[model samples]
Target: MRKSRKLAVLTGVGLAPCLVLGLSTTPASAHGWVTNPASRQAQCATGTVQCGDIKWEPQSVEGPKGLKDCAGGNARFADLRDDSKGWKVTNVGSSTTFNWKLTVQHATSTWQYFVGSTKVAEFNDGGARPAPNVSHNVNFKGITGKQKVLAVWNIADTANAFYACIDVNIGG
Candidate 1:
């Protein structure tokens, strides 16, 4: 069997210089996390915040379905569970748009939005692959002050779901 290739090297001449490409051989196990208003993982992924190994694979925070915790119960990313890690909080108005960045698109079962233990909204995809740029405008009209919204992407074909926690100062 051939080994999985995570990196591909390429060389160019004349008009362009050499370039290196990063690739994932495994398709089913990779993809996605909330972005807009910037989820904790998104911030680490972009260098806007410092973190551990999660900084390299923010889209890989997959844990079993129905889990309520961020980092998706993955120990390597347990830093995401650190409430005092100084995650940058984005100030926003009500009815905020939650954007998802997909590194590898896959069939999705549902998208859930939550504030603490309270589920604010849910969108059922019925096991359909999502659009390239996935986003949802969730109503936050009744919510106020500092809150952490947990966004979950349930994969249709797997027992796992990707998790992200977005810190926000709602109604600010």
Candidate 2:
């Protein structure tokens, strides 16, 4: 019985390294990637944009972060026209270089930008032949903490209806 016990212990010890190696060999999923502001960490959250009118006020956030996946089976947007349908920035901290992810459901949809109440940028489909879903990265440099950032989807023929979700990193 002692010999059997020893053999079992040895077997367990021998398998430990293999188990560790096997677990370590697996590749991790890249759902969201952000740059860490401190330690010059390359991973962090610049910002996130969701579809619909923003109901909540923008909240400050810190640390490396990523936008959550769309919820309620509906895409999200920023600066929604309706007061009840808009996006909010949470855990926002002082940084620059906004990294955004935008997915347009309709080809006629366009993404509009604003700094506070002033319009800054506008992204249009530009009559792309194949009107399908597309992703875009928006960079807003020289952004201050007090300034408000807004992105909206303006549809051409569909009552300004479009869906968009974005994540931004504010570090260079």
Candidate 3:
């Protein structure tokens, strides 16, 4: 009985580090589906936010439609709006550049970026089905400090298709 007890204790001790490592290695993503207990919906609202169906993995956006659906009505409005909050910069050091990777479902869809309600950038979908990945970066020079950055998406001729994500970053 004593030998068996000693073996068990030794096995547990050996497994402890592996357990800790496994728990700590979980990937951190900026966006994806999020659960809201209050409304019982996967939503990103005033207090609670949902990341939508897209998953951020391998330093790239993954999962269905990704950032594309965020702009057009092809994605559920709730998902787009909920995931909009992830595109912010939490810190700013001097001059900074903002980069975005976007995927589109329809060529008619388009995207726009705004800084404090000011139009900063825009992209057209070019009417290509299975639209190619689009990337855009904007540089802001002389960033004094941290600021609330907002990126908004607008689909042409589609009502209720607009979504916005807020990030705290420099020159946003």
Best by lDDT: 1
TM-score of candidate 2 against the unseen true structure:
0.33
Going through the candidates in the order shown, the clash numbers are 0, 28, 13
What tens-digit string does per-residue lDDT give for candidate 1 at 31-95?
Answer: 89888889999889898888999898988999999999989999999989988989999998887
Once fitted onto the true fold, the runs of candidate 2 whose alpha carbons sit more than 4 angstroms away are: 1-104, 129-133, 146-148, 163-172
Residues 3-121 of candidate 3 have per-residue lDDT tens digits of: 99999999999999999999989664333211211111222333244444433221122222223333333343434434335433355444334343333343345555555545556
Q: How big is the RMSD of model 3? A: 14.9
TM-score of each: 0.82, 0.33, 0.38
Worst 10 residues of 2 by lDDT: 35-44
Evaluate all candidate structures by whole-model CA lDDT and list the values in order. 0.87, 0.36, 0.40
Clashing pairs in 1: none
Q: Give model 1's TM-score versus the native structure.
A: 0.82
Question: What would you estimate as the lDDT of candidate 3?
Answer: 0.40
Off by over 4 Å in 1: 1-29
List the candidates ranked by lDDT, beginning with the highest.
1, 3, 2
Ranking under TM-score, best-scoring first?
A: 1, 3, 2
C-alpha lDDT of residue 42 in model 1: 89
